[model samples]
Target: MERKSQIPRKTHILVISQYFYPETFRINDMASEWVKRGYKVTVLTGIPNYPMGKFFEGYGYRSRRKERWNGMEIIRIPLIPRGNSSVGMVANYLSFAVSGFIWKAMTDIRADLVFTFEVSPMTQALIGCWYKKKYHVPHYLYVTDLWPENVESVTGIHSKAVIYPIQKMVDYVYKNCDRIFTCSQSFIEPISQRGISKARIEFWPQYAEDFYRPVKKEDSLEKPKDEVLNLVFAGSVGYAQGLGILVEAAKILKSENRRVCFHIIGDGRYLPKLQESIKANNLEDSFNLIPRKPAEEIPKYLAWADALLITLSKSDVFSITIPAKTQSCMACGKPILVSADGEVQEIIREADAGLCSDAEDVCGFVDNIKSFMELSTDRRNELASNALHYSETHFNKERLLGRLDEIFKIGA
Candidate 1:
């Protein structure tokens, strides 16, 4: 008698995110990594309109709707472009959620599990919930932003009338999801307060991409040929970033005749206001506002700097956030200059990676910058070494991805 062997089935994962590849998010790398690990991955995302508030050159509502990238399938749905206005942004989010429902009705894609990479608006998780209901699969939510709080922070709307409904929506999503993963440990209590059990929520911090590594200064094309102490801040320049403090700090540094230059890279809604502040203060020479560059090119800019700058606005929601850039900066082996609060400041202190100041503290931030400028070359090197070592031990990409794999297997 011959015995027949049973073959294992491939786990198909459906990822629901409003942003995806070509949008400069870590989810792109995660999806690719999953594909490399032999999981069948399909991404359901909207047209690529993000920090720029417009669609990418080649992507649109009517074109490039379905594509393949890095061995995974990408299905883009039609949504309103995110123009530079509050109404436009709201419309953009609603359009995606509405379109997602329509797409699910017409499509027959089935998956073993549903995963959502939630950043803002948080409404995208509804799509994953719908899929879970239809396919009887577990839905995992990776929450990068806390809703109702995030909405209040981004917009100035504090009315309970509006926030109550948003809070209800958030509660529904959290309740429906099988498991929830948060980027910061502080988020656990908040999620639990929403009637979710602590056991259902886990803290799964983000890891840096492989490309984010130490680059020799001499090899970096972006390196400035000067003796000035270069401090580089790379990421979105939104109001939540609290970059306005840099302008005031630059004025103080310039008055003291310090050879320090603040280099801010990236673009957002608040860029024009920041530029105007620089021009108004006549500190343009001390502050360099470079245009946004690709994520792959960020290491080169980091290598050019003596320290990496990280900041967030003074808000309860932001205080708990460990910005994704924190991992990126630590991975690059650069000394960090933090003007944020809570989790990020704690991480910097724990790693001894660099200096920290409370959010929007111009004097404290300036003092930290000056102190770094006064440090000996050996001390600077020590900070850099500490950063890289901490990243390897705490946020190694391989280890985190392996944990993710285990999570999926358990859920499946």
Candidate 2:
């Protein structure tokens, strides 16, 4: 009975995220693990609507405001859905920030620490900052993307007057938060340049979800019996991804009669444009746009690929960011062909996972694809082996969780 006294007190963690379970964000797994470890985990999130804009089926006007998901108490607030336009996206962000503020103000749920899972819209962190101010609890911002820079890059907005308020919002969150956790090491320098102290920010990389692992391809996972070498690009086909480069590469490959096929999965604002480009190029047979599938099904698709492709637009902000899908592809134990610069390239180089070409470099992309195609089976397998090894060594879920646990326990 005396030994029971040695057990640490539970850390009550309140997670604030615009995205959560059933929508595919890392915070879901993190919060689930927190519950398993005997911590009190509560989530305050917006209604289920992301990427696709429309609310998920059975969860619209009459749904309950609060619910339970994976042993945590979830509080969902009403917010505008993110439609596929810059103006609509801004409205969505503002709606969440406003609704989240009202919910937190009225709710009595107390937390030892408030943690935010930041992506796309940086204004969501504003709620966490407000909670910190009101409750005097430690607010930890987990930044997957940086704002103002990301905002300007994604929207192509060059006017300082338009971006100044967003910059102030970013600066406000940065100054008020107790500590910042970032997914990329490269993010540190950029974040510090915004007048934040390096010591307050920690580099915590993204990990593949539990379901993203190597699985044997069975008869049920059969692909069409074509001699075409399959190269797959998975994830949102948005402007940020610069998938037009892949279309250009496909044209070059077809011109030279390279027996390669590019399969693109997932939807975004650019999917229509990508399809149109493929049609106009008369390369529909070479580039296939498969409809988006659920997260669980992605591993099978990865297993079906000869090589996985990842790319980012040629923007300074994106160069510092490593797409979370990079970790997912590596975890699936497949050879990766990267067409991006900076941190992701550095990772691929360090792991010898596959090959890299400059973003938007169509010829460089074509050359890399041809080079990959020419590799012997043994060489390709070796690269695949290296990718699996690197994922296990660096980006496993357990390692990242343990680090986050330590951070949460600080001054507890």
Candidate 3:
């Protein structure tokens, strides 16, 4: 952080995220990409707390901790960690916002613009707005989740009693930011209806540095099979992912005399229930559920599968946003199964990766699976190749984020 500001900075960028590396969220990639391009970047984030809702070992609340990763400076502070539920989650988010503001305000170097991620830090966007006013830090806000709408659909946490204030809070933050980011291709309509102009917003998708490159069939698989098709889902087992539908589709595939296996990997609050559902359905032989693996291990699984599944809930809120897994899956050069509709559907069609089913329609899910399974080897390989090409050109970490560095003037 002591690097000369006279390095002719286009602008100094301060990324305000409740999660970052050592924590592992999309913000880390975004902030780091700018640094790679010679930007002077600093990240203000909370203690490493996620999934477990507790501070990561060796790290605790109070006082600021700083470290350098790949030339970028990451500044982590103590904040109350919240679990993935209403009360605790809100408290966790509030604490980060409160703590980040107190600590960031006292720093010597000022930022030109502040960028805040949408999810978590439920109340932190308001604090970012306050910073914009106090230090004149023009801002960029990324709406990763649609908030009360998404929370209600996933957790049933809000009502008219609770939503109105949240809406106002959303409005306050959006109104103040110079430009807003809506990562999902589907998120534009809802907020645009609320007064955020289309011109002020831009699309930013999750990126993984093409680290998810296509895995060689022989090098990546554990139990290799030359003739059978394998399909996989590699993220959370949570309700928001609509994984129940994946299991249902697996049952259908089994009935059809198809040989494809469904591989689900990742741990979440919903894992136990998912296991129970599998047992109740007697699907032990057809589906395989595995624990989450290290980040470096993902491409191997993608290489092991013929196609990858990506889904969002039937929740009105989730339909508008494409999950990051969709991009990761495509990056691996695997064909895609995008079960959620709208912009997500458009993305798959555009990529020529694979087909989408009607949201929540198990019958359609089964049909799509069968069709993909029935494809000729040449056809399937062609689709997979198209998906990989699309991802590299459109979603790679370096190419997709140049606008971000330009906006912050950090790498300009």
Would you estimate the TM-scores of all the predictions?
0.97, 0.95, 0.90
C-alpha RMSD values across all candidates = 1.5, 2.2, 3.6
Q: Candidates' lDDT values, in order?
A: 0.91, 0.87, 0.76
Better of 1 and 3 by lDDT: 1
TM-score, predicted candidate 2 vs. hidden true structure: 0.95
User: Considering only N, C-alpha and C atoms within 3 Å, which residue pairs clash in candidate 2?
Assistant: none
| RMSD of candidate 3 to true structure, Å | 3.6
lDDT for each residue of candidate 1 in 175-201, tens digit (9 for 90 to 100): 889999999999999999999999999
Candidate 3, residues 237-259, lDDT tens digits: the string is: 67678778877887787777777
Q: Lowest summed lDDT over 10 consecutive residues: which window, candidate 1? A: 216-225
Ranking by TM-score: 1, 2, 3
Error of model 1, residue 410, in angstroms: 2.1
